[model samples]
Structure formats: structure tokens, C-alpha cells
Target: MRQLIIRAMATGTVATLALGACSSGSSDGSAKGRTPYIGVILPDTTSSARWETQDHPALEAAFKAKGVKYDIQNAQGDKAQFQAIADHMLKEGVNVLMIVDLDAASGIAVLTKAKQEGVATIDYDRLTLGGHADYYVSFDNVDVGELQGQGLVQCLQGQTKPIVAEVNGSPTDNNATLFAQGYDSVLGQLYNNGTFVKGPNQSTDNWDNATAGKNFTKMLAQTPNIGGVLVANDGMAQAVIAVLKQHHLNGKVPVTGQDATVPGLQSVLDGDQCMTVFKDSVKEAQAGADLAVNLAKGQTASAANAMVADTVTGKLVQSVELTPEAIVKSNVQDVIAAGAVTKAEVCTAQFAAACAANGIK
Candidate 1:
């Protein structure tokens, strides 16, 4: 899988095909008098702000640019709603279906049904562990975790034997597991060498920020000297930061996050968060859109250059694995330049000086 992903990155074929499709101007790709349509089911809006704020618009623009008929809906974190939306889309005669599954069970059920209906299925972000999908599009999630772990290590460079607590994402999300694996691989070395003390490690339910805050609070109470935190994403990081602030340890202890949301960037600028990982949603959306367009048009969808193993089935699934970047205070402006966040959103009155200091105009 790593070799395939490296080959794809080296060749850049996925980006070329996706970009070419958008500019081709051959809108109608239907066959047998059937109107080609794509259906997209998002997992939820709660886990990260990216689903609605980034992925949705990026996907809408991509589909519109290709002149494809499509429907995009969010399950709002409800498994039943996710299934209902998939059933309705299938009933409406969609030729391709893409999803960011809430869990393997719910996603497997939806993917299985779509396959039975003869529809092409793509796993958008979260890959269903046992489910079969024609293609999968997501960032290299383990790499994302490794970056977070490295960021926390960088932040605690001089601290001797600092306790590091981990606030991981939802247990049900496969990405979370992969993320933990990545970070633990890095942090484990420090723990083994006695350079860092391991503290409480817990996963939040549904990536809930409130639950994360509660979990971190309990962990802090149990071990009050936690010098660093390895949080899974920006939302949960924000929760952990809140707990740190309650104890007046906000900027004193370093925290790592992902998604590079406005709050996360602001936190980084203000020295509250040590770092974040930025995954280009526009690029991801375009890749998925390109695949759906090909499937909808009855054309042979270009095979993604990468592959990821299905942990449950032990089969490698074709995948479009995008690279992720780590963001620190020195490079916060890069995210704004990449169009992930606006300067105005991240550089409010409270953060104005920090923005200016970081060269963010």
C-alpha cells in the first residue's frame, strides 16, 4: 500500500485525471438512455467543521464544473439517517454512491445494498473495514497521526519526563485507530527510553468535544502534571485546551490537532495549540467527483494509483491517498494561502497581533 501510494504521488496521475475531467466539457456521460447521477452521504457535521464548511462546497463546485447530476446529504451523525438517505438515493436511480461512513456496520450495510443495486460505491473518507467499495478517497490518516505525535514531541523538546496524555478520536472510526497507531509508533520510543511518562489515554465517544473535555479533565485530575497532550483533531484539541485553561495550563502545555480549522489555527497562532495537520479538502472532493463522474458516465473510471488494506477482509482496496501537511505557528499563513481558511476568520481582533506576527495578511 505504501509503495502504491508513493508511486501515485510520484506520478501525479490522480490529480491530472481529476483536473482533466473538470475541463473536458463533455457533460453527458450516460448510457442506455439513463441519466447519470451521483449520490453522496456525509457522516456528520459534528466531528469536524470540514464536512459542511470545506468538503461540501468543494464537491458541489467540482460536480457543477463537470455538469454532473448529483445529490449530497449529511447523516448528521445518525446511522439510521445515513441508511435512510442512501436508500432514498438508490431509489432515486443514482448510478454512483459515495459515503464517509459513521461506522463500519452502518457503512457496510449501505455499501452492500448499493452493490446489490448494481451501483458503483466509493468510500469518501472513512473506509468501511469489512465493506467492499469500488474506490476509496482520503488522506493518509496514519501519517496524519505521526505528524501530530511529532508536533507534540517538538513542543515538549526540553521538558524532562513530562507526562503526555492522549485524547483520541471515536473508537468506532477506523481513522482514529490508524491515527493512534501512527502517534504511538513515535511516542512509544520516548516512553520506552524514559524521556516521557505516559499518562491517561482515552477515546471520545463520537468525537464529541464535550466528552473529550470531560475525559481530559478526569485525566488531569488523575495525573495533574501532564505536560503535553496528543489530541486526535482540532475539535477534540479545543476541548482539551479548555480543560487546560481551567487549570491555567493552556499555553504552558503543548497540544496537537488536525483538520486546520479556524479555531485550530487561531489556537496555534496564540500559542495555545502546538500544531495541526492540513488535508486539502478541495483536492479530495475533486478526486472523488472525478471518479463518480466516470462511473456515472459508464466510462471506465481510471484506477486510483494507490491501495489500502481492508483490516477485516484482508483485501486491498483501490484508493486515492492524498498527502497531509503539518502546520505550526511559523507556517500558519500557508494554510490561508492554500485557501483552507480565510485570514479574516482566523485573525480576529483578539488574534490580530498574532496574525501580524505570523505574516498573515
Candidate 2:
């Protein structure tokens, strides 16, 4: 379960994001006149559809603008295959390797090998450790969880004995740990203070929706009067809601989710989900592309090569973190403004009335 990112201060213009920080390399990225090639390795083809549906497209667009070529691969959740993917990309002479490792441990081994070959490696979305990965790029997950907790609390609206259930993401995902930490900071306080009682607290592997649905069904059975559910992401939240519908409990219980997926937004409109965290994947993908291009050209990522001790490995590594937004019915327009989703995507015929009532038009 990845935690939610808190709102970041507006940095003025969108392009100004370039000046923030870099994952690795020097300030200028690479040297001049190098048309470097990049390799993007994804963990799996599941969870949120944004990786293929949104991220790949946006990243390709960014790379095209820089006159760069990129090769993208998916490991399909296989450990050996992930390492093989990295080996193949490295053998292909890719200047930089960007990976969204589904299996962090195996990914770290891949990065270790890549580092031996002088290929700059980035731990994308999921952090890979082993003194090999050069940089990390992801949302402030802990803050994202905090936002979900806050949103759920507000949705409950003074329910003194609110009963809440938590459905976290994959246990293998360290991001889930960070997210749980963030959520605990908020809800843990209430739970400890006797204002809210936690019902079922479980972690879903692979962020699988069906798995989430089953776990939620069992959770609802354990606690028949669930007031709210804190699901790690929109994908899992949708599954939880589907189970809720089985008990005719949909829309009656406020649910929290991350990832402003199309279905997630529609669920929000339909009143099945209370809120979701919108991490501008395009922005994140563009940033990764920029860093990859720079690294491939033999330039530094940016002047900011600050070090942070890894919680998992205790090794210092370069990092660039982006803040995620809290998306609810009231501020769904912000997501549209960011071009994260199309108006038509959320304002379909079935959602026409809800969209209008929410002022999404």
C-alpha cells in the first residue's frame, strides 16, 4: 500500500517543475550532443491501468519532444523475468534504466547488476534498494495516506464511535508500509483516543481488485456496521465497493482511495467512493523522462543530489518526491484542469446528472 501524498505548494507555472530536483546525475543531466536511449521496466500489467493507458503515452510524448528513443517492457509480475528484462535492456546499450519494480527485492538485484554496468537506474513508483539504484521518484505516499484518513474522518462527520476498515495494498510493496504509516498517524490517533474503532485491518497482495473484493467481503462480515473503509488505491477501493454492493451497503459507507482512475472518479460521482488521491502520473512520467534523457546524454539529473538514508537499507540515495492531490466531488475540477482526465471521461450519460450536480461541467 502506497501512502497518499499531501498537497504541495504551487510552484507557479507547470514548467517550473523542472527546477525542483532530480532523481540522479548532475544538474545538467548529460553532456551535449548525445542522443541517449532510455529503457523503462514496469513491474506488472495490473493494479492501476495508468501505467499503460496514461504513463507510457505521456512518457513517450516527453521523450519524443527531446528527440530520444525509449524501449518499454513489462515483467508481468515474474521475478526472473524482471531481472531478465533489465539484463536485456542493459545489453541493448540503454544509457539509463527506469524501473517500476513490482518485486522490490528482485528489482534491487537487477539494479545491482545494472549499476555494475555503469547504467544509471531509477526506482520508479516502488523504491529498490541494495546500494545500486541511483535515484527514486514517487509521490509523498505517507502524506497521501494522511489525506485519505482526513477525508474519511470528515466524511464520517462527528461519528463518535465510527467503525472503520482498512484495506491496504500489497505487502510486498514498501510504499504500502509508508501509506499505512501515514494513515495510522491520523486514524491511529482516533482509534487510540476511543473516538473511532478499527474493524478489519488487512493488506492485499499485488493490489489485486478481486483479492481486495474478497477480503472486503470477509471484513464486512466480521464487522456488520462498517462506517468507512480506507482502501489503499482506487483499484482496491472499487473492489471493496463491489463487495459492499452485495450487502446493499454501497454509497452508505464512505470509502477512501488513491489513484484518480476513470472508474474511481465515476465511483465518486456515483457516491460509492468518498475521495481519491490524484497523483499527476503524466507529470511524474514526464519528470522521469526528463531525468532519463539527461542521464542518457551523460548529464546530471539536477544540482540537487541531496542524500537521504534509506529506511530499508540505511544507504544514502538520491530522491525526487512529488506531492499528490486529494480529489473529492467538490474539487474534481482540479483534476480536469490538470488534464489528468477528460470531462467526457467523467461526464458520460450515466454520470451526466451527477457531474452537473457536482459542478464538474
Candidate 3:
């Protein structure tokens, strides 16, 4: 839930993205004439829509441009299925296997198997805790959480003894852990300083929005004075907003979310959501492609690999960590202008006036 990705997370540039369109796929599903194959395993269709909606398409374009054959599939949150998919890809003799683990345990197994088969593995988006991988590709996850926490602090400007409820992402997700580290640093300080009150702080299982909504509703009931909410991603934030509306406390409470989803942005436009974090998908996909493509070319490592410290392993895995952006009413136009979203998409009939009002055109 890192609030739909802090409602983010996409990364980007026209020239960087253009690399994906540089080469076309070969007829034999190989990279040029290398007989290269790349396999990507996404955690689940439910955890984040970006897996299918953004990463898949972007990776496909990247691999196509490199003339590489690839197999990408979703695990559907099942460990068995993830193993099965990995088995198949291994049998395909893939040169690189990238995965977004559902949990560290399962991810470790998959990574271990890939290593045994002599395939280069990538820890994409979510890190496989304590697992060995060729590289990791994701955004500055802790910073993503920090943005949410900072945004929530701003939202609590007028409130007194504001009860700040935290709806974090799945505990098993590495990105979630980093996000928690970020928000906790910010909000925890506030709670200690008597600036904000700590209310219900819970992590969702599998980043389930339904569970997040229910948990948030119960928190509201127990802490009738909840003033602001820090939801890890846009999906859970949307759920929380629904519950807020039912209690007639929607816009009154400043809700911070991550993942600049369509609804998250609209919520910001309507003032129901205080802010969202934006990570460009294209940029993240580009990073993963760079690693995967290089591996397929038999290159071991590159200087572009980012140095990221893995707290659990006491080692820094070669990573490609991008930055996150804070999305608010003041700067939302940046998202539209960056081609992350379109005027046609955001300027709906109800939002058209608001879009123009916000200089979105």
C-alpha cells in the first residue's frame, strides 16, 4: 500500500523512454541474435494496478526496442503460482528474471532457484528481503513515505490534537517497510512534540483496500476525533475516503496518499485527499530494462547501478532507485504537463471546470 505507490509511482523522460522504442522484437523472440529471454514475475494483480497497467507495457516496449524476448506474468498473490511461473521461465532458459515479490519468503525461494539455474535475477519495485539478486529497481521508497508524512503534517495545520491514523502498505513488502520508516520518522516526531496525535496505526495484509477501509472505519469509531489519515497508497486512500464520506468527514480530514492514481488526483482536486506522491512508471521501467537488457547482453554490471543499503542484510544491493514527487493542488499541473496524465483524462465533465481552474489546459 505505500498509498497506491506513495499514489505513485511512476518515474521518466522522453529520451530515456524513447530507448524502449529504439529496437523492434526479433521474429524468434530473441535479443538481436543472442537467443536472449527475460522473465518478469509481478506480485499480484491486486497489490498495485501499475504492474499490469504501467510496468508491463513499459517493459514490453523496452524489451521490444532491444529486440529481446520476454515473459511477464502475475503471481496473483499465490506462492505456488509464483514458483510455477518461475519454473516455466527457468525452463525457457531466460537470461534475466525480474520479480516483485509477494513476500520475502516466497521471493527468496524464487530468487534462490533463479540463482541455482545460473540466471540473473532482479529485485524489482519490492525487494526480496535477504535474497540474492543481480540488481534492484525501484523508487526512493522511504522518501515516498516521508512525502506522505510531510504532507499529512501540512494537512494538520489547523487541527488541534489531531488524531493521525496510519494505513500503511503490506508489511511484507520491502517498499512498504521503507515507507513506514519514512512516515514514522516524520509523524512519530510530531506525536512526541504534541503537534499531532497518533491514532490507529495498522498495516494492511496484501495491501488490500477492503481491509484498509474496514480497519480505518473501525479506527474512526474508536477514535471519534480522528482528524487526518495517512494511507500508504491511492487504492487504500480511496477506500478510506469512502468511509470518511459515510461519516460526513471527507474533506474535513486531510488524507495523505501515495500513487498518483486517477481517483487520487481527483480527490486532491476535490479537496478530499490532501496530497499524493507521484513516481513515474516509465522511468522505473526504464531502469529495470537497463539492468535486464545489459544482463542479456552478457554484461555483468554497470556504473549506473545505484548504491542502496539493505537494512536487513547489512549490504547494499546494486539498485536503480528513482525519486518521488509530491502531488498537491498547487503542483498537480506538473503531472499533466509531464504527460503522466492527459487533459482528456483529468478534465472530465465534472473536472473540466476544475482542470481549467487549475491551469491544467
Q: Which stretches of candidate 3 lie over 4 Å from their true place?
A: 1-34, 303-305
Write down the lDDT that model 1 would get: 0.88
Which residue runs of candidate 2 sit more than 4 Å off their true CA positions?
1-35, 303-307
- Best candidate per lDDT, number? 1
What ranking of all candidate models by lDDT puts the best one first?
1, 3, 2
Global lDDT scores for all candidate models: 0.88, 0.78, 0.80
Higher-ranked by TM-score: 1 or 2: 1
Kindly list the per-residue Cα lDDT of model 2 for residues 174-233, writing each as its tens digit: 778888888888998999988999888999988898999998888888799999999999
- How close is each model in CA RMSD to the real structure? 2.4, 4.1, 5.2
Clashes of each: 1, 18, 24
Task: Name the candidate, 1 or 3, with the larger lDDT value.
Answer: 1
TM-score of each: 0.95, 0.89, 0.89
User: Could you give candidate 1's per-residue lDDT for residues 95-206 as a string of tens digits?
Assistant: 8999999999999999999999899999998889899998888888889989999999999999999999999999999899988988998999999999999999999999
Model 3 reaches what TM-score against the true structure? 0.89
